[model samples]
Each structure stands twice: as structure tokens, then as C-alpha cells.
Target: MSRKLPLLIAIVVILTGSVYYYFTFRRGSARTIQTFAYLRDPASRPELRMNAYTQCGTAPFIFPTDGLVGFIWDDSFRPGHRHQGIDIFAGTDVGVTPVIAAYPGYLTRQPDWKSTIIMRVPDDPLQAGRQIWVYYTHMADAQGNSFISQQFPAGTSEIYVEAGTFLGYQGNYSGDPNNPVGVHLHVSVLKDNGFGKFTNELEIENTYDPSPYFGLPLNARENTDTIPVCN
Candidate 1:
């Protein structure tokens, strides 16, 4: 009976571990599972590619994270509401998820409304210097307000960043500080309106389809891809 007592205790320990695995690891959150799978093989990620090809142009923008993501570029979600930018959803979100600088450019922060970060990338790299703006927004804060100013209070002063610079974590601040658009990042590209100021992103018409903007695999399906983002 003494020998059997030790065996019984071992069995009980094993059973407890199995139960924990079943509840905690094996049956993890949906986002957690997706994130893991995405890191293992990114090209198989349909959630990130759902409307990436069909709707948001054939350009597959760089997968910004090893984390699982969902692309919401189609503004058709609501009538009369033209979403000018694309929203990328990350896994079981925490506040620290890094939003990478999509291109090598100068970054400036507008501490109004959504607290937008605009990157000015070179337009005519081969010729005389010309620049274009890539607008990114919804940087997260518990207050649902300006995280950019809190981090770098330099305001609109230009700060140069490379393609992989740590822009900030995913944000959701819209206009009201109390309400966020959710845990995600919104991005758009802008064209100069010829008056020395860029077109407003709110117009939808002013923004370019981000699909062809970043070095996305535009129209090239069947390629599992990866991109270098910030830590």
C-alpha cells in the first residue's frame, strides 16, 4: 500500500497538469492562437488578407506584427460613412503593441483630434527632393487621448524615422477622449493639394489607397510574407 501511495500521488499531479493545459494552454484565447499561428507562417493569414486583395486594392501591405491581425480597409461597413483609411487589428491586445514606421521619412505629430502621426517620405528619390505624407493614427492611451505628445511633446516638429522605427503602440482615440475606435491602428497616404498644404484625410478623396503606398505585395498573391517592424 505504501508503494501504491506514491504512484497515486504521481497520477494526481499529472491529472492536475493536464487539466491546466486543457483550460489554459490548449484552450487559449482565439486571438492568442491566431497570433501564434501567424508568427509560425504569415502567408497563411487570411484574417489579415481578408479584404486586402479584393477590396483594399491588390496590394498586400507589410504584415506589421508577428501577432495575428485583421484588416478592415473596406468602408462599406456602414452606409454614408466613408472610412478613408485602413484599420489593422492585433491579437488579444495589450497597450504595448508597437506600430512601426511604414517608410523612411520625417515624422510629425498633430496633437488634435485623433493625435495623428504623419510621415513624409521622399516622392522623387531619383530626381530633386519631393515628399509625400503617410498619415497614421489612433495611438492607444487609457485616457483615449494623445499618446504622441505624452511620449514626445515636440508637437509638429519633424522627427526623422526609418522604416522600422517604433512609432508607437496601436491606438484607438477618435475625437472624444472617452471613446476610442477600438484597439487598432489607422493609416492613410496623402497628396499635396498644390497650396503648400496636404489634402485633409477626412475627405476620403484626399487620401490614397494605402495598398499601393507601402511596399506591399500589390496584386501578388500566393506569397507568404514577412516585414521588419519595430520592437
Candidate 2:
């Protein structure tokens, strides 16, 4: 009887160990399978294009025709904050320089390029309420005429701009040229999702800081051959 008891105990221990091993292995395998499934899902793909092109023009140190001085935060504009966009120096000397689209997308023209260009990226999935938009201002004619373009004021219906397509010219319309500074292309980006998109609409509306997106400085000087002719 004593010998039989040891045998029976050994059998029970073995069975218990086997059961533990089975459950442990099963759980680990299940986790691995779930991870692989998540990786295979198409919706989890990355959105940013590393080598994508910008929607602005390619000219020899010339101003973008989209005439813009800088951007002002909506909060800054309301009361005593007093803020504005970063103005890229587009000297009055080079008036009406052709502005081109930085990237290929649908163009939403503002009353003036002075402050907005919403670009819905071609194949990017909707990021909730984050839509990319660019803004430019401080536009004027060679004769120094500065006024918000008469075409569209609040917003326009639709305008197609291919990469490098002409938009408009640069000028010093934001304020007097000499009082504080000269004309410049104030470039900025705003993201919108449309739902409660009204709040926090402009994400990174900084001054002409398109370096990360376009791989160039705000005032990049391209080769003469690439520069467009003044028309």
C-alpha cells in the first residue's frame, strides 16, 4: 500500500505539470497570433510621406504669388494679445511673383491667400478632424497696391492646384513696409476634422517654417533655371 501511494502521487504531479504547461503555451501562442493580426491590418499603416513635395512655388529667392506676410493666432487677434504670422521677406521689388502649389491637392481659396490654403492630402486616411491647410498673405501689386483679392473673401468653393501651379503674387498688405518691416510670405499649416473642428483648428500655424515638410528653409533660393518668369 505504501509503495502504491508514491506511485499514485507521482502520477498526480505529472498530470498537474502537464496542465500548467498546456495553458501557459496556449496563452503565449494566442498573444503572438493577436500581434500578427494587428500588424496586418491596413488601417494601422503610417500616414506621413517622407519624400512628399510642398505646395509652394519654386523660384530663385522670389516671393510666392500667394502674397502673405504672416499669420496671427485667432486668440492673439481678439484682445490685448496682439499676434501675427511669420512674414517671409518678399521685397516689393519683386512684385507679382508667381506662387505655386506646394503639393497636389484640392485648393480652398480664402478671401485672400493672406491666411489660408486647406489641402486635403491625396491618399491619406482621415485623421478624425485634422485636415492640412496652408496660409499666405501680405500680397500687393508691383505698383504697391495692397488689398485682399476681390475674388473670394471668407472662402471659395474649389480651385485645383497641381504641384508647382501658380497661385498669386506677394506684397506688403499686412501693414506698412517701413513701420515695422517689409513684405514676406507668412506660411502656416492648419489641421481640421470638421467635428468640433472649430476648436483648436490651427495646429502648427508657425511662420514660414516649412523645413520639416519641404526639406528647405522658409526663404530657400533655387537655381535660376528653376525660377519662374515674372508675368
Candidate 3:
């Protein structure tokens, strides 16, 4: 038995490594299977596409863009990384899918920002006596060319825009031309700091779960196995 002990130990090590790899990497791939499939055939699901200025179910806010919601709020791609917003994949060529305002607010586009915009809502529709901000990004090309509408050019600030106003088209900008992300719109509901400005949106603590805002299952942890669709 002593001579066979080494082989047994080797087999155990191999099995253990396989299990670990399955859970670590393959599990993430399994989780995103639906997302990738939706990206390939987004037209298969019609309910997932909400038009601009239209509310899903009883949600007070309108859908900002039309596409399959491939990622939801609080989705984590890796350890210690939580996505702060929902990513709506347009399944079309860059700059072909239009993104619109989900709510009426004051829009601002910082001068140097190539792919971002923020809207300030003076009165939070969900919370009383508090302000909030709707943040959108990834609206530029891989080379940092803006796809935003020409009317709201760079340095736009405090311009009141009604719901359904054309904001821009989706792009695959990830701040690096060589490493562009998928063509999607990242929209987040940001909490306002005590001083009337939006807090850091990168932190999940500063962003709210968009489920209640859109009246759908938009929390990644809760809405697995399929892209979020309006019922």
C-alpha cells in the first residue's frame, strides 16, 4: 500500500485542482451564459426592450435605452468588484443604438469627459426630501471620440432636458482603444452627497439598486439565469 500512496495523492491533488478551477472560473462563465446569448440574439426577446419615455410595470422612471439588460446592479465580475450600474447591450454596431433620458433633470457633460454624462434630479422620486443623480457612461468610440448629440456638446451644464431626450448612441469605449468594452450603456442611480453633489459612483454604496427605479428584477444577485425583461 505504501508504494501506491504516491499515486493516490497525485490523483487527489488533480481532482482538487479541477474542482477549484470549475468553481472559480467556470462558474463565472456559467453565470454570464445568458448574457452572452442575449447579446448574440437580442431580437429574440422583445419584452426586454423598453422604448424611451416608457415605464416598465409601475416604475416611475423610463427606460433609458433599448436593448437586453445583460448586466444588473451589483454584478461582480471578479472578487471584490461590484458593478455600480446596469449595462444594456445594444447588439448593434457602435453608435447605431440610441440612448435617451430616463427622467427629466438637469444634464451636465464635463468638458474633458469623452464618454459620460450626469443628470441632477432635484427631487428624488423614490426618496422624499433628497436629491439624486442619473449617471451614464460609455458613449464614446474606442479612440475617445464622443458619440453624444451635438446639441449637448462638451462642457454642457445644468441644461434642463425632458424625459426621452436624445442623449447619445452606445459605444464600446473603455478608455483604451485596444481594449474597448462591449457596446452597452452603463446607467446608474447615484446618491447625492450632503452638499448637493453626487457621491462617487464607482462605489456600490453610493449607488442604489435600480430594481425599484425600473420596476424590474435588476439586482444581479437576485435575477440570475436570464436577462431582465418587463412582465
The most accurate candidate by TM-score is 3
The TM-score-based order of candidates, best leading, equals 3, 1, 2
**C-alpha positional error of residue 215 in candidate 2 after TM-score superposition, expressed in Å:** 1.1
Q: Which ten residues in a row are the worst by lDDT in model 3? A: 22-31
- Judged by lDDT, which candidate is best? 3
lDDT of 3 by residue, 97-200 (tens): 89999989999999998999999999988887889999999999899899999988999999999989999999999998999999999999999998988999
Better of 2 and 3 by lDDT: 3
Score every model by TM-score.
0.59, 0.42, 0.85
Instruction: Give candidate 2 misplaced runs (Cα > 4 Å).
Output: 1-86, 92-94, 111-118, 122-130, 141-155, 175-181, 193-209, 217-231
Superior candidate under lDDT, 1 versus 2: 1
> Cα RMSDs of all predictions?
16.9, 21.0, 4.6
Q: Which ten-residue region of model 1 has the weakest summed lDDT?
A: 219-228
Candidate 2 lowest-lDDT run of ten: 220-229
- Candidate 2 global lDDT: 0.40
**What TM-score should be assigned to candidate 1?**
0.59
Encode model 2's per-residue lDDT on 98-201: one tens digit a residue.
44555555666545344344544433222333445555544553333543344434476456556655555555454444453344444544444444221233
